[model samples]
Target: MVFYALGSKFIQEKKDRENTPPKAQEVIYYSLAIGHHLGVIDCLKPQITCKVAEYDAWIAQLPIDGEARRKLEGVKRFGEINIDGTHTHLLAVALHHSLPQMTEQQQQWSRELIALLQRMENEPAIYLLVRRHDDW
Candidate 1:
């Protein structure tokens, strides 16, 4: 959310984390949602963080049991895709850098973002490839 708010130079990235444990994901979300307090000497650049800690705290306290509560207890990161500002600007930027060999269309690329980047990363792929690409 805040990343796109910063600007429009985003490129899609894919990762496979099929075996990542739930606790690790929870810790990541908690870190983002409840952002760290900056030191006075720190730089003032805008930080990208989920603005949903209060809601998450409330949800965590609800009367629920077992996996349901555990899932909610995992911090829920929130994002709102700026349909006009971010998406439109991204479309324009991509078109500006478009190649003659590529079929660039705003209609194809400008769909409203509908889910968390983390969720997209963890989703099972429709097809699997044996080749491995190392990220690190």
Candidate 2:
């Protein structure tokens, strides 16, 4: 009789556990959709652009779990994509402005960026490819 009650209770608890949803991971991928949209040229210009510092500060402020924090640190080691004003400006223009809004040259730049992102998605590892390509 006692064994039957215990077995039923265990089954009920198992069902409850199975019904519960898993916790969400805290680290979010920074993207244009999330308002992390930084300009390539703007990022490139360190002297004039505080975006990298600002982003770092923002990340520090988030209340993330230890796993997410570790992942973010890994991401930070890659450094800001822009060390010069030129790349920062180019990235910014590509992400924020429409082709119609840009001059012909800038439109071409946007097309290149779109292609790059698509290619990156298909590649097995973006960081590995980028590091190798950059000789970093």
Best model number under TM-score: 2
Worst 10 residues of 2 by lDDT: 1-10
Q: Which regions of candidate 2 fall more than 4 Å away from where they truly are?
A: 1-97, 127-136
**Model 2 Cα displacement at 116 (Å)?**
0.6
Q: Which stretches of candidate 1 lie over 4 Å from their true place?
A: 1-16, 36-136
Candidate 2's residue-wise lDDT over 1-136, tens digit each?
Answer: 0000000111135466466453311111122112213432211111112234433443343234433334334435764221122233333333344455455544553465445444334531121111101222
TM-score for all models, in order of appearance: 0.20, 0.26
Q: Go through the candidates in order and give each one's C-alpha lDDT.
A: 0.28, 0.31
Residue 46 C-alpha lDDT in model 1: 29
